[model samples]
Target: MDSSPHKLYHVHGIDSRQFLEHYFSDEPDMAFGDDLLKFPIDSLRQLFTVGHIKGDILIDLSLGCFIHHLYSASEFFKNIIVLKANNRCIMELKRWVDERTGAFYWGHASTFLQEKEGYSDQFGDKEGKVRSAIQHVVKYDPEKENMTDPLVLPPADCVIIATLLDVISKDQDDYIRYLRKFCGLLKPGGHLLLIGCLDTTYFTVGKDKFHVFTYDESFTRKALVREGFIIDYCNVKERTAVSDLVDYKGVIFIAAHKEK
Candidate 1:
């Protein structure tokens, strides 16, 4: 039997607005709102508050233009470097940073984070803080030996990748290879915070389905260990919301550090 028609994120271009509306929107009915937004934001809030992940530079290589987690991250890391797989994503993110017209509104996300952290107001400044903390937004080539060719970034103190690997990786080997590349971006003992799904196969954006590598929690731990990372924290949230856009069994948050 033929599988559903779909596109590979690494090859096919994405519609940034459609992608955000489908997966990252704050609408209560959106299937992935909790899994993609609230879960990671909560986890990052705790992790950053514990005082272990702070640094001068934090590299963000997440799946799309989402920045909910960065509101918490900006408070800890002085400089944020965003790396994207395509220029479209880069431009979309830049639009938000520059406060350009038609930029996707993330106020709902900021409000969500603030409420959780016991802040009642000042929602207006959330974007400003993230924009100021964001030092650079650059494109990266995952196929290149140096993901950021011609722009050698100093090894970061921390790297946060959310829902990116499973979409970009085709197989277990590809997962390991990309994990190694992510490791290369961190300094010795630098922390790596990864957020993605477990046992997922596909996710839809707009009208096209996109591939998501199927892997469970154990495989992820083994992959990180093999890539020279010492796992420090891991959390998994079973599928709670219902949706046909993606068939993910659960969401996962993992924190690890490169072997010093």
Candidate 2:
């Protein structure tokens, strides 16, 4: 089936005028268009300005909408590293990133890089070896296992970016610990960009069920502090309500500098 056309909307809670003024002034082309989800892209643009991100190493945690943003700004990254707890996202990102010119790596958060089923689809023609080109693919369940040691990968001299991975309010402690481990993946003074789903309900993808973790700015701020990151900037915006559909509520974006 053809992929659903990307849609954009202004989520409810945020000040749309201020958000547009702060981030989308130039009217950049968004992967999901101008309406559906506006907070993430705008926040990203602002974060990119706080420090030097061009030619930096970006570690993207969530693969759905976040991947689109990374691809949208492909020219700026030196290497893009993607980690997804979800198998589908990992596969999708690997395919999308491989097609681009920059270096791309994919795997689970707890594990480094290991191949798994449903990772690659059968292709009639082989332009490049997508499977073989993968340097590392580790396998580990974030909830069940702990990443005792950081996965060894290529060194990144610049920033590390991740989003939509940690914001489950109920799992606050666990999420904070996870965030620390994620920070360890980056170099000291490296920038960490994060986008998280705020108040929302349980949603299902295939057989997997995801529960919501309602989070506000204060909670996130404290978590960042505990994780040893200096808050560069943060913004929370409510996702515009879609009639008759499950309400996503809102999302939060944070750009923090890893303390040296």
Identify the leading candidate in terms of lDDT.
Answer: 1
In candidate 2, what are the lDDT values of residues 93-154, reduced to their tens digit? 45543665432321121011111112343331222233223333333344433442256544
Could you tell me which 10 consecutive residues in candidate 2 have the lowest summed lDDT? Answer: 108-117
Which pairs of residues collide in candidate 1?
none
Model 1 accuracy (lDDT, Cα): 0.88
lDDT of all predictions: 0.88, 0.46
The residue ranges of model 2 lying beyond 4 angstroms of the native Cα positions read: 1-37, 49-51, 63-66, 98-140, 143-151, 154-163, 167-170, 206-209, 243-246
lDDT of 1 by residue, 1-260 (tens): 13866688878968888899988876767777777788888999988889988989999998878888899999988999999988889999999999999999898889878888887868767778899999999889999988888999988999998889989999999999898887788989999999989998888877788889999999999999888889999999988878888899999999999888
Off by over 4 Å in 1: 1-5
TM-score of each: 0.96, 0.61
TM-score of model number 2 = 0.61
Candidate 2 structure lDDT: 0.46
